[model samples]
Target: MYLKGEDISFGYEKKNRILNHVNLSLGSGELLGLIGDSGSGKSTLGGILSGYINNYQGSVSMDGKKIPSKGYNPVQLVFQHPEKAVNPRWKMKDILNEGHAVSQDILDSFGIKKSWLNRWPNELSGGELQRFALARALSPKTKFLIADEITTMVDAITQAQIWDIVLDIVEELNIGVLVVSHEKKLIDKLCHDVVFLDDINNV
Candidate 1:
């Protein structure tokens, strides 16, 4: 399956534009690196591609059809901040359960401890919380993953671990991944191809 965004353009206000006629595509099992400076609207494009920003101009389609307007989305997005993603009132187990039932093997692969499931979001470390976030995003129905600087807030070792788990899972599941980040080493190391925002955006 392919998620294609054609002529995507959006902005919060009329005068200022963030994304302008940006085109991008990711097929199953492919990993694409999106590199740009801060405030370059990489994350905004990711959001539009994933159906989070529906009011934007242009079109995003899965295969040849538009994405579902409701229910489970095949394109899953893992944001930079895990703390803001999950419900702080709920325990980790419940939060993970928001998606499909994650297996013990999946937890082990992401280095998520059994004990961590019982803790609140506030109780776990940033890396630990991020692991759960990744697991939740990798549900069986997910055809593509839009990782918008997911590991930027973590330490180097933790970032590596997260990326390793993500790569392994995406390979096994044949899920396409669009990694939006400013990390040059990471993009070079993980992406099959790299594209810069200015190359495709008409802005």
Candidate 2:
């Protein structure tokens, strides 16, 4: 397996478990959809898969080795709110090349013209910023991505365009993506397989 999580359970108080025995497995090039209601542990599960929350009961592994919670690389997450995920003061170029290599073509693919790189994050509209965020995440040596409701902020047309760019990048890089969303249509459109969070035992 490329990445796997088994019997994972977590909550703030040890006794109150928010996630109940969640299990998931992903191949190197799989795009898996995580669908659930608003507070059904969708973002929480994304956090676990990205190694942000490791205090859970069960096991999570990447490339068959245990996942390191602190300072872990190779995984990235794009949150639902671009403003929350991105640094308002930083330029798009800075976000992409933040001590890492980034290709010019990747920016171009996200509809970011060369001139736009010099502009701060605040200058771009929400849709543009989200696209840049996606580009930055894809710029690194990211093997897996946890996309947490990445299209919710944009209009329908922009969402379609952004999804296309993401799909293209994932195909080109052969990356695995855990796309978390409440939007069933998007999940059906992008995912190779779907994991319904409501079905905790099966997940």
Candidate 3:
């Protein structure tokens, strides 16, 4: 497995558990979706798998080795709200040029224009900002992406466009993706495998 969560369990309070016992595995080039109602610990699992929540029980590993806390690459998260994810002070070009190779074709596909690259986060509309966030996350050097409610703030047209860009990236890079969403329609459309949080209960 490229990524796997083994019998994981965790929560804010020591005695109160949000996720009971969860097990998940995804191989390379796979696109998986995790869905459930709010407070169902979906994002918590994302945090754990992405190495943001380390105090949880069980473990997360890549290629059979323990996933590192400090230097591990190849995994990145695109949060629901782009405003929350993006730095208001950074311009689009500054964000995208952080690491990944940028091209006119890539920008065109995400409905972004080269001319807008110099604009700050607040200058763009919500959907545009979210697309910029997606671009930035995908811009990094990585083989796996955790898209956590990536389309929540965008409209239908923008969401569809973003999904297309996401699929294109996954295919072009042969990357594994774990798309966490509460919307079943989007999951059915984009993911090859679906993992429902309600079935696993608290982990």
Candidate 4:
């Protein structure tokens, strides 16, 4: 399967545009990196890919069909801010179980302990909360993963651990991935191909 975003144009307001005619694609078992500055609409594009933002003028398709508007999305997104993405009222176990029941192997790979599941979102640190967010996104139904600066706030060791787990799953499932980040080394090491936002975005 292939995930494709073609000629995507979006703007916050009429006077100016953030992304213009950006084109991106990731095939099964392929890893694509999107590199750009902070406000270059990298996250916005990722949002579009995952059906988070739908006001753009373009088509996002998987294997030539339009992405489903209802039901579980084949594409999943993991954001940089764990606190903003999750429901503070729910415990970690509830959060992880919202979409699907994640495997113990996945929890182990992400370094999520059984005890952490009993705590509230505030009870855990930022890094710990992020692990839950990631586990939620890594459901079995997810075929594509868009990581929008997901490791930006974590420690180096934690970052490495997450990537190690993610890469393992990517290889195991032949999952397509889009890594959106400004870090050149991270993109270089994890991605099979790279596209700078300025090179593709007409704006």
Candidate 5:
């Protein structure tokens, strides 16, 4: 399967354009990188691709078909701020299992202790919360993952560990990944091929 975005464009206001006729594609099992500066609309494009933002011009499709409007989405997005992505009122276990029954193997791979499941979102550190976020996003139904600077808030060691586990899981599942970030070094290290936002975004 492949995810393709063609002639995509969006803006917050009429006069202030962010993305302009950008085109991108990612095939299953392909690790693609999208590199850009802050406020360059990389995250916005990720949002559009993952079906979070719907006001954009042009089209986003998977395997030449429109993404489903209901039910579990094959394209899952893991944001930089995992805290913002989850509900604070819910416990970690509830949040983790909100989408599907996250397997014991996945929890074990992320080093998510059973004890952590009982704690609130605020009780865990950013890195710990991020592990849960990733674990949750990488469900059996997920076909493509759009990771938007997911490890930006974590330390170097934690970043490496998270990526290693994620890479393994995606490979095993043949899930395509779009790694969006400002860090060129990180992109170079993780992706099979890299697309600079400047090169694709007309605006």
Candidate 6:
């Protein structure tokens, strides 16, 4: 399977465009990196690919078919800020299981404690919440993952731990990943190929 974005273009307003005529593709089980400056619309492209933003031009398809608008999205997106992505009112367990029932093995792999499940989102550290966010996103039905600077807020040790577990799970599941970040060293280490947004985005 493959995820392809063709002639993609987007703008917050008519005069200013964030992305323009950008094309990108990722194959199943492939690890790809998207690198660009902080405000160069890397996250916008990721959002377009993952079905979060729908007001863009061009097509985003998987295996030559349009991605479905309803139902569980196979293309899952994990944001840089886990707190913003989840509901603060919900307990950790409810948030973790919002999409589907995550396996106990996945929880263990992410070092998510059983006790943390009962706590509120704010009670846990950013790293802890990110672990749950990732665990939830890596559901069995997920075909592709858009990781947008997912470890930017964590320490080096925590970042390494998170990526290690994520890489292992994605490998086992054959899920494609698009690692979007400004960190060149991390992109070089994790991705088989890298795409610079400036090279592809004609804005």
Q: List candidate 1 segments past 4 Å from native.
A: none
Can you write out model 5's per-residue Cα lDDT over 1-203, one digit (the tens) per residue? 99999999999898999999999999999999999889999999999999999999999999899999799989999999999989999999999999789999999999999999999999999999999999999988999999999999999999999999999999999999999999999999999999999999998
Measured by TM-score, how close is model 2 to the native structure?
0.91
Local distance difference test scores for all models: 0.90, 0.83, 0.81, 0.89, 0.95, 0.96
lDDT of 5 at 129: 97
TM-score for all models, in order of appearance: 0.97, 0.91, 0.90, 0.97, 0.99, 0.99
lDDT of 1 by residue, 86-169 (tens): 999999999998867888888888988888889999999888888999888887788999999999998898788889999999
Of candidates 6 and 2, the better by lDDT: 6
User: Which residue segments of model 5 deviate by more than 4 Å?
Assistant: none
Candidate 6 has a TM-score of 0.99
In model 4, what lDDT does residue 8 have?
94
Query: Which runs of model 6 end up more than 4 angstroms from their true locations?
Result: none
Give stretches of model 3 more than 4 Å off. 99-105
Cα lDDT tens digits for candidate 2, 8-103? 888868676788888888776798998988877889888888877777788888877986655536778888888777677887778767746667
In model 2, how large is the Cα lDDT of residue 9?
83
Candidate order by lDDT, decreasing, is: 6, 5, 1, 4, 2, 3
> Per-residue lDDT tens digits of candidate 6, residues 1-203?
99999999999898899999999999999999999998999999999999999999999999999999998999999989999999999999999988899999999999999999999999999999999999999988999999999999999999999999999999999999999999999999999999999999998
Better TM-score candidate (1, 5): 5
Residue 194 CA displacement from its true place in model 3, Å: 0.9
Q: Decide which is better by lDDT, 3 or 4.
A: 4
